[model samples]
Target: MGKTVKLYVHWVDTFNRWVGRFAMRLIFVMAAIMLYAIFSRLFLGRPVNWVMEMSQFLLVSYYLLGGAYSMQLDAHVRMDLFYGRLSAKKRAVTDAFTILFVIFYLGVLAWGGFSSTEYAWSYNQKNYTSWAPPMWPVKAIMTFGIILMLLQAISAFFKDVAIARGRPIA
Candidate 1:
């Protein structure tokens, strides 16, 4: 049992590290986009056509993709003072409820976001600028990110259940 837990922990750690790397890369990608936009505006006669919106889209994508990584590491913000003192079963219950609440919220976000994205796509959405691209692709980020975040939350809640059952979370 210990060996199995250790193997799972090792795998989880590997996944955590991989996701961290990707998150960092996304950060750099956003920064590069901003710099390029600034350079284009400063050095060229034309400013970056859609850089601001593109950067924002990249950032949303990063947060959605990076959320699971944060959850895996137990790095997310939570008020855990009493939580640490709770019995394992109690802790599991709390964790489960918390995640269920999050799931509800994410479900709302996903539904609404999907509707907006669909509307945009169906209408051949465009930006306000001359280089306007279809806005649906950008809008889709909300749905994707929220869904992924909800999945990670569900996974973490189950992890707590496992822990309460005397099984290792990993």
Candidate 2:
């Protein structure tokens, strides 16, 4: 691997690690919100209208933001029926090929997310709920997450190619 490729991989890995850890903390925030809702409804005789929707948004953000780090950790689920028996190099070769499909999927997702975010921002769109939060922030985060996942996918492809070529990127 060239110095540039190694640097790119390292930077992306580091950034995703930070973002993923941040996203992980959002789970606790979501839990707190839920608990607040429960306490308010039970003790104060009123339920928070935005609690469920806010929790859903947090959940979406959590998974989307954590996606690249999951990929970096090789923690994503896969069918291991035949894969488990493959040699390391063969697995690298197979991963190189399969990651193309993932790249394509993320590309489409990013495009759609960008478009949605643009529309939301242009129209000042808001969720059709009682709380009615503006939709642009979450949509922008979605686009960003998809793009990060795409970048990580490309980085993984590069590493896999290097591994398949018998020059694995450390």
Candidate 3:
């Protein structure tokens, strides 16, 4: 039998890593804006809409991008009572099953998210407010983030399978 590669999932991992790391830099930007907003509100007695809006946008990207990273590090919220107590072999089996479930879950999310992104892009969508920026770009990030999560799940599924079988993983 030929060795099969999950290319789509791999690409998802690559994309997720890139975007996740890139999003980290935005923290500084958000902090700077936050300081400014605080200063403006506390001293100047006024808050700028653009700063608030931009912060919201940056936060959206930060969280979406971090989703896959959290998955990569196994940091997502989960009930771990059974998972935490399992033996190595049992854990591997559970891991495989869990990853499989995530694959399907994230698969659907990516599908719908991508379609949503496409719909927004097709209409040349923009935020319905002053300083209207194109929204499709942000939507695109959402879809891409989900895709990366799905891909990481696939690779993890294979990893758990290999571990369960007492085989070395590549």
Compared with the true structure, all predictions reach lDDT values of 0.75, 0.94, 0.78
User: Candidate 1 — what's its lDDT?
Assistant: 0.75
**Candidate 1 TM-score, true structure as reference:** 0.78
lDDT of 1 by residue, 129-168 (tens): 7778788887886676666666666667666767767775
TM-score, one value per model: 0.78, 0.97, 0.80
Candidate 3 stretches greater than 4 Å from native: 1-18, 39-47
Backbone clashes in model 3, listed as residue pairs: none
Give the lowest summed-lDDT range of ten residues in model 2.
5-14
For residues 8-84, write the lDDT of model 3, one tens digit per residue: 44565677678778887888889899999899989999976678778887888788777787776777888877788
* Global fold similarity of model 3 (TM-score): 0.80
Model 1 CA deviation exceeding 4 Å by range: 1-20
Q: What is the number of residue pairs that collide in model 1?
A: 0
Which is the better candidate, 2 or 3, if ranked by TM-score?
2
Over 1-170, each residue of candidate 2 has an lDDT whose tens digit, in order, gives 88999999988888999998898899999999999999999999998899999999899999999999899999999999999999989999999999999999999999999899999999999999889999999999889989989999999999999999999888
| TM-score of structure candidate 2 | 0.97
